[model samples]
Target: MKTKTALVTGASSGIGRDIAMILSKKGYRIIMVARRENRLLELAEKLPGESRIIAADLSRAEECFELYEKVRGEHIHVLINCAGFGILGEFEQIPLGKELEMLDVNIRAVHILTKLFLADFTAQDSGYILNVASTAGLMPGGPLMASYYASKAYVTNLTIAINQELHSAESRVYVGALCPGPVDTEFNDVANSDFAVSAMSSKKCASIAVRQMFRRKMLIVPGFSNQFFVFAARFLPRRAVIATAEKIQSMKREEQNS
Candidate 1:
């Protein structure tokens, strides 16, 4: 059997990094992508199998296109769109430029890469694409972190639609969305937010995500509580869901201010 290769974005830290490590241990060569070249180099050294590093800022459209070009021929058996960040603040209060950047990474990047690779994978009739979304996307809306939540919702819904398309076509190409809740990673630090609930370790989150990806799960919501939240949201009134998200995000803002 030919050795499989996986391309993982946002691999410098957090769930992306953990998934890379896990894939390496599973004997898949990982092509790590992130803006932090030094961090990628360090992770490459630790991997049990072969690895390559591509340092690119995924927020830029050209960079996202270029990234796909760089690795498409490598026969990547899996593509993990794990490169994304969120900001916590009132929708209007946050700088528009920053929100755009976040959307570029969280929405645009994921959209572009998924579109390009889905074509390739569908043509070959074999591959897996795991998009790292969030439980924030599952809810109706978020209050303080409105833009961030909306960005994730785009990812989640996009993945859902794509999965439906692939299934309708009876295609073997697998596409899934990993909608994990607050993970104990550098995410909160970078997003300038606080977790209202205890954060799960990145290792645990990655383990579940990768495992579910292999199992062909459409929506890989990690924790039981998170699964429940997503399910419960469907039955709750839209306004109530928004209000709950408001309380959670409001706590994050309060913590940041303190």
Candidate 2:
């Protein structure tokens, strides 16, 4: 049996780390990428199969391309973009510079890596690309975390459109989005917006994402409750949906402050 290689961004922690571990257990050699070199090193050492660590901050566009150049020779069978963060506040109150930086890492980084790797994958006619968006992506709006929501929306819609293009071209390559809802990870710490409700475990989220990606699922949303909520939002009035989003995010803030 041949050992496949998977390149996972944001592999230092959370969904990315768990996915790397899962893929390694499946006998795939993992290429872990993140800004935290120490964490990546520790994770690589713990993987059951062979693994490598590349500590590149995807916020820098050059590094995104550099990562690809460094790994282009490797027969990468899977590419997972999970490097992202969110901030919770009214759109006007949030710092513009901070939101711009978030866009660099969240939207630009994913776009760059996905496009570059997708071309390579399509050329070879084999590869899986999974972009980790949030269930926030499916919603019409996010009052408190507007920028973050918009970033994820871009990821989700881009994945859908690209999947359509691949199908039209009759390509075997697969591209999908994993839009999990409220996964318990360092995201809350960074976003400063803890979930008002129970959060799903990151391990479970990663497991489901990997399984569905291989099954060629275009949009993988874990948990039935989350799936139902996303579906129900479509029929609700846009104004009502936006108001509900505000209530939910405000609850998270209230919980954090309490």
**Per-candidate TM vs. native?**
0.98, 0.98
Q: For residues 1-258, could you state the per-residue lDDT of candidate 2 as single tens digits?
A: 567899999999999999999999999999999999999999988999999999998989999999999999788999999999999999999999999989999999999999999989988999999999999999998999999999999999999999999999999999999999999999988988779878999999999999999999999999998999899999999999989989999999998888
lDDT of each: 0.94, 0.94
lDDT of 2 at 156: 97
Instruction: Candidate 1: count the clashes.
Output: 0
Stretches off by above 4 angstroms in model 1 are none
After aligning candidate 2 to the native by TM-score, how far in Å is the CA of 247 from where it should be?
Answer: 0.7
What's the lDDT for residue 257 in model 2?
86
Clashes of each: 0, 0
Deviation of model 2 at 29, angstroms: 0.5
By summed lDDT, the worst window of 10 consecutive residues in model 2 runs over 188-197
* TM-score of decoy 1: 0.98
